[model samples]
Target: MKRFFIGLTIVIILGLFVGTGYFLYQKSEEPPIIYETDTPFKTDIIKKTIATGSIVPRKEVALKSQVSGVVEKLYLEEGAQVKIGDLVAKIKIIPNVVALNNAQAQLQTAKINFDNSEKELKRQKELFDEKVISEFDYNQFLLDFNLRKQEVEAAENNLELIKEGSSQKTGNVSNLVRSTVNGMILDIPVKEGTFIIESNTFNEGTSIASVADMSEMIFEGKVDESEVGKINVGMDLSLSVGAIEGVIFNAKLEFISPKGESDEGAIKFDIKAAVDLKEEYFLRAGYSATADIILQKASDVLAIKESNLIFEGDDIFVEVRTGEQQFERRQVKTGLSDGINIQIAEGLTEEEVIKKL
Candidate 1:
């Protein structure tokens, strides 16, 4: 019994030694992951959103003809600078045959009556002066002669208007269409022989030309409904044109549409920005541009890489390096964030080291 007990004890002791050796060997084979700390640097960070849009002129004017006629001449072409009262085009008369013939017949009848009445009036006046005619007869003859003369004049004026565009008294209405304002001719829609209709009270007729004051330019863009409420008139804006890259122009918010429209489930508000163009930069009408309105700015602030920030519920935390092998999660207060970088309002200073990745 003593020999059996001693043998069992030896076997148990050897099994324990082998188990301990296997545990130590497994731990040594595992790989280790290490992280490094970075020295904090001073930098400026701003949060902004990007929007895409096009540039448009501050004002646009469309010129239209005033009478229905064939175009006789077009003095100004596209991109022509013109002043007020400059003649743009002329219209040649295309008479109505039936109306012209009627006017001519009326004129001949009026002339016959006017001549005969004048002769009778002269004889009657002489007889009255010689005491051989009554005063009533002379007055009647004088009235009849004046009526005939008026009819003759009316017919003659009508005939001249049908043959030409206007009589001597009604000067030429077809010879000129003077510009109403000073501007550059942006477009000329009519050729020399193109027919045009007058813009009247009932309808918007054909457009003859388009003129605009190019000196005044504006930026038209849209902002998401979420950001629209934050903007107001007179706010400064930074703009970049798609065609003119690497340059940014400054502007001010001039208009905000009170209404909003839904686009692809997102509500958007239209905004107009008035560009303050320098004498060197002449902004052409309808150039595409992107505008950035600064909502907030800080003169001097301590900021950090945006990726370093972590959130738990509503609170923000950052991993602060404590020692070569130790780190702790720290709570921090934050201010303005410009998307790429964020301002560290509390729990950080310029000399503190941080982990970037």
Candidate 2:
């Protein structure tokens, strides 16, 4: 009975070991990699380079103040539509104390001169009427009186302008800052009560607002310097905005920077393209966008997936499926490739099945 139990235990242990070994062997064996095959099809091949950029107005102008003063009033807000010569803001001129004093002194001097001229003119009139003075001398006195009166008027206007940034002579244009272009207001950086400087020869002045022609927008992006040489002005660009999905904006290449900029230790060139926005679509400025610039395109050509092509030293080839799971190496001349489908210029037919590498 003991021998029988021992023999049964040995048989069970041997059977378990054999089964475990067989399972391990099967798990270690990898399944065959079934290479997929694709047929050459008639398709358009567009060789393009991608550039990351933003949608901005072609003409974005920063509205700056012409006079230094506190922002007394802002006529427009962000996102407001504006036209050329529209009043954008009112700057309360904080006149210089010295300038104000000088203007006041000049005004008083002109007034005194006018009063003396008036007395002289009256005396000259009396002398002329009495025939005691020559006609030429009386006329000279009359001219001096008229000139002094004019000087007094000019002095008053100048004093008003220096003190209040406006004068009676100038209409609503005084202290008023107007838009220089027809566009939408993008931003009003300065609020009412904010002190701002005027744009002058010494300083660029404080920017009150930024306006842009939203109707005429452009894609401004940078591309790798290596790809810049292939692109030129007037190339077609397909732009995709991140914020505005489901719509592709069409644009034409307009300007490419003659110089390159350094980013992340790589040289990149700036590029600008005019965006053709649809009537139903309203694109806000500074929207992040990506553009695929078409460098070259081939129409209705026999093409295959670029992954199907194999490269050798100075040559490109593809394996054509001649039989079941059998492929024959054939040299192929390739043309345009948009990084996906490659145009087969020669050595392949539309009906031929090629093995994917």
Candidate 3:
């Protein structure tokens, strides 16, 4: 019985050894790598740069006060359409004490002088009728009376202007602020009873409201200094507004800044483009937008996936599949890339299959 048990144990050990050897042999073998393939095809590749900015009216005017006063009434509100010479707001003049007093005093003095001149003219006319005075002397007295009468009228008009910001002789009132251009009212910055300064040589004055020609819109954006050299006037741009979804507006470049400005340690140049507005959509001023400025474009050209390209120092190459699971490296000349598909300017054909990296 002991001999039979020992022989069984030896056979069991031999079976375990064979199983371990087979597992080791299987682990040492690796699966063959199968490469995926792609073929060059005709496609449109556009290389572009992006600019971020806002949509604004090409002509925007700030309505300012012509005379200093307190706002009494506003004739228009935000988003209201207005025409040229339309009343926007009315101001109540707060007359200066010194100026008002001076005007009143001048008017009083002129009236007294006029009363004396009238009496003297009447006396001179009676003497001339009696032949007691020469015609030339009577004419001189008449001219003096006319001059004094004109002075009185002038003084009255000055007093009226000082108190009311207008006079009877001038039909228009200075305190009535009017729109200088035809546009839509964008903002009303002041409220009732708000004091405002007049626009003059010394000060810019307070803006009562802002009006802009909404029909004529423009895109005002800034591009990086590195990309500005590639763009020029008359180029086309596609605008995507943040507020408006699924709509793209077309624009033509009009102006590019000759100088660059620094912002956050990087230089940028300002660019303006005329937007072709659509009648169906009303674009308000100051709408945030982004523009896609095409730097270069290739249409109906042979292109391959950018991932298939391999770079070695100054040369670019791709692997061409000559046989099943076989590929050989071939140098290629590439042009405009939209960051996904690249244009194969030379060294590749649509009929040849290239290995996908």
* Number of the top lDDT candidate: 3
Which 10-residue window of candidate 1 scores lowest in summed lDDT? 40-49
lDDT by residue for model 2 over 135-207, one digit each (tens)? 9999999999999999998999998887777778765445788898988999888889999988989999999
Tens digits of lDDT, candidate 1, 154-186: 899988876666778767664367677888888
Clashing pairs in 2: none
Better of 1 and 3 by lDDT: 3
For each candidate in turn, the TM-score is: 0.80, 0.83, 0.93
Tens digit of per-residue lDDT, candidate 3, span 1-357: 999999999999999999999999999999799888999999998899999999999999999988898999998899999999999999999988999899999999999999999999999999999999999999999999999999999999999987898889876699999999999999999999999999999999999999999999999999999999999999999999999999999999999999999989999999999998988998989999999998888999999999999999999999998898888999999998999999999999999999998
Stronger candidate by lDDT (1 vs 2) = 2
Q: What do the candidate models score in CA lDDT, each in turn?
A: 0.81, 0.90, 0.94
Specify the poorest-scoring 10-residue window by lDDT in model 3.
163-172
Candidates, ranked, TM-score: 3, 2, 1
The model with the greatest TM-score is 3
Q: Candidate 1 at 278: error in angstroms?
A: 1.9
Name the TM-score of candidate 3: 0.93
